[model samples]
Target: MRTIAIGDIHGGLKALVQVLNAIEVREDDTLIFVGDYVDGWSESAQVIQFLIELSQKTNCIFIKGNHDAWCERWLRTDTVDSTWYLHGGEETMASYKDVSLADKKAHLEFLENMPFYYLDDANRLFLHAGFTSMHGVEKEAFETTLYFDRTLWEVALTLDKRIKRASAFYPKRLKHYEEIYIGHTPTTNFDSDVPMNAANVWNIDTGAAFKGKLSGIDIHTKEVFQSDHLPNLYPNEKGRNKN
Candidate 1:
């Protein structure tokens, strides 16, 4: 009955599978994926298919990512922005070149239905990116910000919680959750493969889209599970090595 929050998969199905195997999910356990499930490696379609199947066997929450939004657009219109293609969309489309119509439809529906954010009884916020300010997921404005905002993480990284408590200039609702878990900003930016926490927010995207591993953490116990570096799993691919 553990609650696990997984970082971005970014089409690294092998890494995703390795982390899942390590988790040994139980019947009542819940899995929360922070999104970016596609647009990297060569198995974006396979990753979606696995997730579609996994949803039937276990409790799972899939949060839509910016990359996923690109996928949704392409899935529906069959055309997408060149920016997406440059940032791994080509590989993603290639992964599904031979996919069945039914599978693509299923994947499309899945992406379309994905919520921007998820909250639990423990008051933990799970999102793909960052958010401005919202009490409820329904009240979210500009859903893309949930997967694109960097300001929140920057504040979390620099803000002193004690000063925040004492400051009258800041809103009382500055942090409305016990913990916030996000995945858009990779922890690798901080030169770490493990999860990084600033204030009460946790950055778990350990750059699996690049030369890093896929990571998953037990939200309640703080137990972490990580897969091998994706470049090793995908020897022929360069992934997203920022120049």
Candidate 2:
């Protein structure tokens, strides 16, 4: 059975479907989504509903993302955060305009129950963003950092390729996992539209929220599956690029 690490979706349900179809998902394959399931494109609510149903037919692990946390709060309290509203939450709110209160409550529960990070039996770590603790995720002092931090990726990128894991200069955080898979920081930021690896960390977020494609990678083989660019799929939408 193959385990696939899917990148940040950001409400592109069409892109999500295309990527899954590209992967040709089997009954035994496990799909681990790194998160940001909502807030960006026009299908935020539909993406959540699709994921809820997908999990029932196959094994899936969903990690909570910062955008998702903001959406969840709005769903539960009927109040919007200005920052969130500016960053694609407005689109997310619009997507749920026709959703029933009971369906919203169920979606809220799904978001509320997601784990911040997941560790597989192979010691691979999957998280929406990054963690700050040198001792690993369990020792993280602030839960918010798990989905909001970028320092982890920054540090990984700066590490010298010559530095061996056994060397004194190796970051303790990177040493904690056999391999780490993360989303949140888009690979497009580095001028690439595909997944990028820094040190032992694999960043799968291909920036589907903006102009990039949704991506998924096989953890063991490192085979990548991508959907058509979001802009191509939704011609009239600006997505989060409007921000």
Residue-wise lDDT of candidate 2 within 76-155, one digit each (tens)?
99899999999999999999999999999999999999999999998999998999889999999999999999988999
Clashes of each: 1, 0
At residue 58, what lDDT does model 2 achieve?
A: 92
Error of 1 at 24 (Å): 1.3
Give me the runs in candidate 1 sitting further than 4 Å from their true place: 134-139, 161-173
* Model 1: number of backbone collisions: 1
Query: How much lDDT does each candidate structure score?
Result: 0.88, 0.96
Which 10 successive residues of model 2 have the least lDDT summed?
234-243
lDDT (C-alpha) at residue 149 in model 2? 90
The C-alpha stretches of model 2 lying farther than 4 A from their native spots are none
Candidate 1 lDDT (Cα, whole model)?
0.88
Best by lDDT: 2
List TM-scores for all candidates, in order. 0.94, 0.99
Against the true structure, candidate 2 has what lDDT? 0.96
